[model samples]
Target: MLLEPKSLDNIIVGLLVDNFFKWYVAPKDLWFLDRKKQADAYIKKFKEIGLKNIGNKIEEVDERKGIEVLDENSFIEFIRRINKYAVSTNELRESLKLNLLTTSKQDTFYSFLPSLYVNVDKRELYSLYPEPASYEDFVPKNWSGVYEDFLPKIDWEEKYWYDKNGIDLLNLENNRGKK
Candidate 1:
């Protein structure tokens, strides 16, 4: 899974769902203090973190693995699920967008490119299925080429504001205040 800290809700949901699989579906003893307790903990954390308000049910995600995070095949399925809950309420969609800062003037940091936002985030592998150990499992050939061509399309200066001038401008006000 590629995780963007900017998408806290998505990350939390993904982690809880993953933990649920490790605790119950796989029947791993060392994964938690107890399976039931672990499930409850996951639920509580979800609620505490405000995911429940967004209609993200921590209990509902199927534990069966082999789910691709973002690919052509999985994109359709992911959109269907998102529409089921997201389309019903306008407020929820806005909340989600706001939470992700998808419309921030700063640039799109979180993209729902298949599932939810691709931010050049680092990838980690956690699967319930006996698949390849990491994201290497789903990566297509020409991966480097994909990055070279596709990544450049996303203007990093506009999106992440990492340029030296941008950094200096961002800190200018604070630096002046300190002086």
Candidate 2:
């Protein structure tokens, strides 16, 4: 999350990046393979935080070095500080401003890897140890409330692929029995 920062009055600062990952990437089930092994793998992945600069260039950050994890009390304070930034200051009805963050309360958007926004979605997460991907989850998270195998984004089936004889490949798949 944060490499190092000074104390904020009595509260410690810096807990965005790691906590965000915990909320998402940290698998809810701990009883697969082995507990210690799975935890180690998860923590190691969290250490490699993704960063994208203003230029949209992405990079990997090892958050483990010289970093401090947030305690329960400090974490609550951190969330409060974050929420203060999320309050929408720009009234969309009055102005034509389209920047979503113009009215957001997040003080800063940590450009987690593969992301350009302060809030990183699951699609932006890169796995160091990737599990075998099932065809079912290819449609990306933004497609709906859940990951689905069938993506409306895919339009190839609608287009025709012709063979040497000009027979459509798609029709051939269905016309297998009819000579």
Candidate 3:
């Protein structure tokens, strides 16, 4: 039976497929031989990342033991479940600052803010919308374990955008008297 693609095996396969196309298919390399060879490099990377037991054949992906395929309904249900448990960036940051939350709950760092803008600085409304987990600022577990080995070198005050092209619509800072 198919299930939501949340399982580790599914995630790995998704990553592999994405990497394969990025390294081969998208480059417009018309030669099948060249593309196939490029795909081999990605396969090697997948294997090096502990998927060696999955065998050496990419064509055998479906038969893989740990492969848990998700159906349409199940995928929707999984997304709903994730959203139900997710917390906003504000909530997550506050909780982390107070030590009420741990990095283990990082998956719940939701950031889907609403498109509507409330033009008020002192009377700002609490955003009821939660962001998708795919946001760059919303880190997930599938990431390389490289970051775990070192302490963060950047100070929080440096300021940066985590969501791509996401910006404040209200411009509240400069809109106080314009109303």
Candidate 4:
């Protein structure tokens, strides 16, 4: 289903927030040097490597272009780029400091998604993908808990089930009850 412009904006913001948090709390071992210095080095390395090599492997799977698969190293590089180019360093530092002060490591505040499906028979909720989504899919790997506060409540009695494509199985008549 098409998302309203505002909904799309929220999704983007949520993604940014989640990514920033992940970047902030990443294991120190991931960067051999200090955080800021490591970020600077990665940015330089990314520039030397060039943009042609940076992208989601899934998007380039067919062509098999010389795309460097986004592993931990690439993730760090991209995070550094965002930190250096997208947001001001002071702003990012303050935001991260505030986040660390107010939010717990286990908090699910940064998690966000467009939808999830409920399986009444199993009494379970899951994403549309058969496999769990990854960072490459723009879905935060560490996010947890349901986003019920903003999303519509599921009508469990309706016994609705959605396919991988997000089509509601029980309500195919007018497709009015889609998740």
Candidate 5:
């Protein structure tokens, strides 16, 4: 999805805030609690720190700077301004790699690829599938042959749709048993 610059900025800030809580606050403050309790405590701390209102501060800065789009430097600056506990820019960039940012360009813009895809390198994003304990667990025994047969024909280059004719193929498959 194409996100507005402000929306993207908000998301980045949120990640920074969450990271701050996870690394700085959680260990010292919420460690003894269960996962659910820790999450509740994290929310309380997040609100108490005024991090929730950081979006307004960001807007003011963006308005003053006349920044319609956020590039790497500007993004880093935003994170630094909002998050006093933020890690170094290099560390931030390393964390963002594949997790939030991708090298894939949509036209002139660097696209933020979804989590399902990993940015393997500067040139490509690879699909991240779950690792099943066995081949039968990954795909049903009945569908294994069909899955293998069609896997190679999948168009990996198509970012949005693996198989361009997937819907047609699916319809054909669905109708096969019916007829």
Candidate 6:
């Protein structure tokens, strides 16, 4: 239940720090147009706009009273936006090169949690909730075909069969060697 940002981002940040150690010497400098402030503002805006689908946590610094520490999601989004803008302006790719937004396998899995984007294999609109998870009469508005043909059919067995005496009827020991 407790999820931490993937190690890849940490590695990327470490690399970035190593490469741009001089840039961080002055935290107030705005060479990249006050990126830290922008990140904080964007996080606040996203939270305000009710787009907090991705969890974000900010650690507050004493001097930076209202502002909070940047978490991976906000940082990554900042990088993504910067990259998009840079590409639009025909900026050299190397100029905006950063690996902070690189998604790892875990990020990919978590990305699918809030919204699903699965390709329908055969097409009867599938509801991925509930159980044997089927309701034959309930057709979705956008009906896609089903992959029923590919589904492995289940051979059901009674997991619990209670007899009149309220005991498991399938227990072999109940009908032992006497017979």
lDDT of each: 0.28, 0.24, 0.24, 0.30, 0.25, 0.25
State in Å the error of residue 139, model 1. Answer: 3.6
Give the C-alpha miss distance for residue 41 in model 2, angstroms. Answer: 16
Top-scoring candidate (TM-score): 1
Q: Best lDDT goes to which candidate? A: 4
For model 6, what is the error of residue 104's alpha carbon versus the real structure, in angstroms, after optimal superposition? 12
Stretch of 10 with least lDDT, candidate 6: 21-30
How well does candidate 2 score on lDDT at residue 37? Answer: 35
Root-mean-square deviation of every model = 15.7, 18.9, 17.3, 17.7, 19.9, 22.9
Give per-candidate clash totals.
2, 9, 5, 0, 0, 8
In the range 1-179, model 5's lDDT, one tens digit per residue, is 12211111212111212222211100111111122333344566678987664322212232214333223223344344434333332333333343334333341122222112111111111221122211122221122111122222222332221123333221212322221
Please write out the lDDT profile of model 4 over residues 19-107, one tens digit for every residue: 23221222112212123333344466577877444432222222112323322334445454434223222333344345446665323
Error of 5 at 62 (Å): 7.1
Question: What's the true lDDT of residue 70 in model 6?
Answer: 25
TM-score of each: 0.23, 0.17, 0.21, 0.20, 0.17, 0.15
**Candidate 3: 10-residue stretch with minimal lDDT:** 21-30
Candidate 1 lDDT tens digits, 1-179: 22332221332111112122110111111112123334455577688977764442323344213332333344345434433232212232233345345455332333222121222122222322212212223342222111121222233322221223434222212322220
Which runs in model 5 stand beyond 4 Å of their true positions?
1-66, 84-179
Q: Poorest 10 consecutive residues of model 4 by lDDT? A: 1-10
Poorly placed runs, candidate 3 (over 4 Å): 1-42, 46-53, 56-75, 100-179
TM-score of 6: 0.15
Candidate 6 C-alpha lDDT tens digits along 79-164? 33223122111111111121113554344322211111112222232222122313222222343423232111101111112233
As a TM-score, model 3 comes out at 0.21
TM-score of 1: 0.23
Which whole-number lDDT from 0 to 100 does residue 120 have in model 6?
Answer: 24
